[model samples]
Target: MPNARISLPKAKLSAVLGHLAKIPASLSMTTIQTSPDGLWLYQSGHGLDVQLCFPEARTESRVTTSVNTAALAQMVSVAPGEAVEVEVGPSGLKFGTGGYRASLNGLIVDYDEPPIEAEGGVVVPIAELGRAIRCVRHAVGGVNRPHFRGVQLEFSPGNLRAVASDGYRLARYDLGVDGPLNGKAMLPLKPLDAALGILSTQDGAATLQLHGGRLAVIGEAVRLALTPMGQGLPNVENAIPKSYVAEAIVDPRALIQAIRRVSLLSPQDNRRIDLSFSEQRLEVRGAGDYGEGRDEVPLDTYRGEPLALSLNAVYLYDALSCIEGMARIKISDPRSPIAVEALEDARYLGVIAPILNP
Candidate 1:
């Protein structure tokens, strides 16, 4: 028998959706099995029987059918109780749910065009897309803020770039793609993420078109369109001065592991990691109710004057892990912001602001 999936109406819809978020977004192949009891979605990688947990409600409905993971992701914005019309096709499947729909003429858009273009078009690897998208998604504001907590995507034909900062932690990743778009724009994390949820399941390189502030992703069997937030993102190049140049070399994972261990002792709300430079050594310190713990990491070589600066451990950890290489890191000053460059290569660059109180 062919496998199928059913969408059951829920009493507590938010809870149901939250649970779904934990499931891998790329598991697009699912079977909706309906039996005497109710409905069950059978898919690889998920263990144990799945049950719908719902509170009291007036009415609920479940639709049992097979759906591509990308098709299910398109319904992310649709509210419960809303009707989702589904139909199958030979080339690609079509469905209307949540924030997306199929046109009356039967035109299905899995991909939208980009606002601008590069020479040959930008081709990004699936794993790179997943890592960069995941890091920045957490920094995007759940609720809209005036100009902060948004994601800035920049392409220069030579590099595909993404950055997200919420005035607390800033995350950025730059990787080589087919085309690094010279143009840039800001898009809310939610929609870009929805697009990635569709991409994560596919293999090979993905093509992107950035035009009119809209991004379209062309994949093997799926296409994704994401409307940019449209507010002009700050000129990231000028957000911090280019002259705050000081250099220190360290391992990406070493710093990450050290901070992760120390952060366990730091308060979540007021987490602080202090860095002090002594000769060629870097000292990391953090304090909490359990007192303070300190760890020293050796630096490859230090340039300029020694300094002590305190930063949010969580933010530094987040930034360091994003970059690849056990190499040098450049800093302007303890008071000024920090910029990270990959020593092994120049695939991407990262910048972060210093915490005032940390």
Candidate 2:
């Protein structure tokens, strides 16, 4: 008996077919039946399946890949379609007239090279995108917090932003896009990291599409898609205090190196590093089991009050590291969080939570 199959639009159906062709033999592929609103990729003991659903016939195409067979079985089964025409090539896998059809672990996988969508969306320079992704990904929360462990991307006309924070520290970067796009999504750390690596190897611009919880980056010859993380990112921008007076400008690497040397002696309880700025001297010192080590860096100018205060050694280092140039750090008081700002090439701001001393 011929397997029963449903009809999917040419554009979407082609995408699903192409994805299967790209799967490596390390993974298996099998034919799937189309369900009422989606298609399922199924396997046997491996019990893995890729379920792709079309919520609205007009919605952007979506592809879901999974290795969980138990979860795949629960998904509704549908009639199978005849082997559609597909093709394989050396540059990369392609599908259409001729392609391989197989099942891996229980899920149908494709190596289809779907036709690239129309251009004229949001485009970001590969270098800028690569830098922003790498810088922010470092600050993402660890895997322990599945929800907050990704970089948040926000896009608007002429602006693109990426931010990451692991509660202890935060980092952000901004880029100027070629056109307009109003959308936001969270890209998982691992995939975002991979994308950065991919962008670094390529040149020119990459068009990014953030529709239907899907992120697609189209470079010169490569097209990549990732499912957006459906979790809330903390509002870090609003956390900055409105008023802060004490400001210190110094070298970022110098500040980081000083913290690293001093941290060796500072007690964990008193992760405190005291800052003394008066006349033409600026000093950062930490006290602990190893006694104390201080680095006094000369200042070009000092406008704030001569002040001494304690701060978390890590937070200060984190904010300083994010700044690309010499940093101007502001201190409000003995108990207020520190504000770190750099040259205004881009409107970037970061505030560290203060450690209150009893």
Candidate 3:
């Protein structure tokens, strides 16, 4: 005899698993809880934590059962039809639909934990959230520095700004909106991704709840929260130069294309491309063991002194890719970092360190 049985829509269950899977697999058991509210799948380990709730899942009574996460994920992925029926019994757990039965062993035990307190969070617009996460994702740190691996978010009553740096390059996005939170917080990619991924399934999902050193994305049907990576957070603002002279305004598409075409003849080892700006035209030069190449692009405007600087072609290309229509290339000197700004959208910014060549 089973203690309880519940039928969950296949689509809903699979969606919940998709979010839970983002949590790094750990020996810490993945458990599901049943109560009057709904079914909650909980998993946490290695500085990442996530909780997903299915408010629609029916339950006969209250119970928390440790489950084989891999088995459950596989079953949900291949399970057929609109709904799948699951039962908890003394011998094991059973799954099937329409009279078919697939019995899988389960660990039945008493588990107790308080629900994620999802209250008193500020409403962050979905557009701002997307912009902040996407721009920073491309520029986060490598394994060289653990602190560089996360992005810092500063919230004020007027706007929200997010910045990320990978030592070589940095990116930031600013959006104007009314936000309740104040002060700056450093959040690792794990929790941000989990929040964004789970939010995609929900309609009209807004607000991020920060409680107990964890950040959560709350939605109508499902909610997820993960721990923030707060230690040794990099000081990014000081590294970004405050003053830059706009040297040239150019179309990003043409510039990116010119770099690709000119780098073909350059060596594969460095991929270092030199930029020489004068008058209304800019020259891109690349040299490698194979040979050398140069291409010229027309600039909309030019200012400051005649400028010549070198940088990795890949880095500049990525920085330019994020800009909108017209991009201003600003530089203070050959020894300083370069700034790429989107004239159309002042909210986005990118900085790349110049490669000093003798």
- What are the TM-scores, per candidate, against the unseen true structure? 0.62, 0.66, 0.83
Q: Which residue pairs of candidate 3 clash?
A: 267-288
lDDT of 3 by residue, 156-253 (tens): 77787888888888898886666567766677777677666666656664666667777666666555666667663556677678886647899999
Positional deviation of residue 3's Cα in model 3 after best superposition, in angstroms: 5.7
List ranges where model 1 is wrong by over 4 Å.
1-121, 135-146, 156-159, 168-170, 176-182, 211-213
Give one clash count per candidate, in the order shown: 29, 24, 1
* lDDT score, candidate 2, position 290: 67
RMSD of each: 12.3, 11.3, 3.3
Winning model by TM-score? 3
**Worst 10-residue lDDT window, candidate 1:** 48-57
Q: Which sequence of candidate numbers ranks them by lDDT, best first? A: 3, 2, 1
Estimate the lDDT of model 3.
Answer: 0.75
What is the C-alpha lDDT profile of model 2 across 148-249, one tens digit per residue?
888888887778888877776667777766465677888776555545543454568878886545776776645566667777587877655677776666
Query: Global lDDT for candidate 2?
Result: 0.59
Better of 1 and 3 by TM-score: 3
